[model samples]
Target: MNKYFLKTTLALTIGFSSLGMLPGTSQPIEVEAATTNTQNNNQAVAAKADQLIQTGKSLIGKSTYSNTVYKPTAPYKFSCATFLMYIFEKNGVDLATYNENYMIQQGTYVTRNQLQKGDLLFFKSKKTGTDPDHVGMYIGNNKMIHMADSKQNIVISDLNSKPYYTENYVSARRVLPTLMSANPATKGDKIVQNAYDLKNKVKISTTNNEKYLRFTAPGFVEYVYQKSGVNLGTTNLKAQMNLGKTVSRANLKKGDLVFFNSVKGSKTPSLVAIYAGNHRLIIPNSDGVITRVLLVDYYNEHYITAKRVF
Candidate 1:
């Protein structure tokens, strides 16, 4: 047959003969053949691993790695860890046993050097030792994929590149299957098109008043009331409240006033407003004034459920 198979067969025949197991009998030869088959199977597994790594890289910004606890669309969206789950799943690996939180916990407790292609990566405010605030997938070669904070979008980043990732570098864990049967690759255009298509299928609206402006989603509305002038609490209030509603739900235009609230346990509110895609939202919270977060940030497990109030 193939050269690899022939070589493996020859190697096994010699090994069995040396052990005195292969007498001048047909049965001994049959045993050697079976042993060769097992070696070939192991080699095939190694090849599959390499192929899966390449597949993961191709899916970089296109596939969703994290689960959308509140997905308004199908095929679903992913976060870092969830995206890794998808990659592993596509390759025939099963990880239904672990959820996002479980994966994050494992990543934080594990060491960096132990990371592999399908492991999880996490990040957070360097000043605060709180929960792993952000998550991503470990795709080997010191690189990771994440739906980065509001500004970055879904992307691949160098593990040691950004100051936050370098200094606050957490942990990584390997949980993918040892072998995958099929591999599918993704491209950037397909990802953008998918996101755009989803956005178009949904309904979005915007409204304005002399003092306040707002955008509406399927079930939620975000409003921004003018502040006499920008202040710390007022700034953060503007951002955290209407972060997602504008771009995602209302398709906001320039010069809009985004609003925020200072309610405790309500670090982030259900609705927010926007001034243009460029003007960032700001609000006062336990951690002081925070600004410039995406609308999806309101859906972070840490924040309250988002509702439209246009």
Candidate 2:
């Protein structure tokens, strides 16, 4: 049991106001539309949001809620905040902690009338007093899905269906933008997308072929760049590291080549990976499978330098 989960309660019903198009907005004007690449990126992010909602829906009957305890693994057991932590982490957006007060402090505040799907909803109930004690994901149509209290497992409820939600609603925070903004439709996004597309589809080998290989971390980065029309020209990690404009770790954009010292305490670069934005890296494992992983702990500690080649 944790202090954060104490005094939690569930409100059975709720509802939200609908937002419709403005009354006089019925004509197309001569204006440029969002770039095709950006549109695609937005679509991809939106798809991820939909997937987040579906993931929460899938846990409905299988998850058990408890205000007194939190079990981080499945078969699942959760508190309201931990439930958000689980679903968001499953979709690659780490909420980081299972504390509602801390979570409410994250992302950016959003007005209740402007709530969008995937926004985190925080509320204060009679038991929780002035502090926000409950959290849930806004799942469009003025509805939200949450691990409602010890009585209700994971379930959905209309926001306006009960006065408890409307009257006590504390606030909402928009975290989807954190994921979406990192993937704006730039050439780098295309390169990162190519890397993702090639994950398990390519063969890693020392022999070079027309279809692509010279298999090594450098080769994988080269292949992904070539597919997206940028040629790095060398298979040597150190040589590749020297080919592009030098970039600091903090300014790295998607598709930037992040070089690292493979040997502990060595300054020379022995490995390279693609920066996939939002602090994620696209690199291959020993078994030759490419994967996206968080850039924390191990990778952060082995940091050498980065370069923007694309």
Clashes of each: 32, 10
As a TM-score, model 2 comes out at 0.57
Number of clashes found in candidate 1: 32
Query: What would the TM-scores of all predictions be?
Result: 0.36, 0.57
Clashing pairs in 2: 13-162, 14-158, 14-159, 14-160, 14-161, 14-162, 15-158, 15-159, 15-160, 15-161
Report the error of model 1 at residue 81, Å. Answer: 3.2
lDDT of 2: 0.67
Q: Residue 127: error of model 2 in Å?
A: 17
lDDT of 1 by residue, 63-180 (tens): 3333333121233344444444444433433332123444453212457876665566766554754555566766668887666643454677898787888876656654332222
Residue 63 CA error for candidate 2 (Å)? 6.8
Which segments of candidate 2 are over 4 A away from where they belong?
A: 1-51, 62-114, 120-136, 141-143, 146-154, 157-184, 203-214, 263-265, 287-295
Candidate 2, residues 1-310: lDDT per residue as tens digits?
Answer: 1254422111101001111223354211222211222343547556656766866776676678876666543456788877776666555454545667667766788999998888999888756456587889999999999888778888899999888888879899977755443434679878876775565565666654645544666777777888899988887777997887998876888789887786767779866788776566677545453333334456777788889886
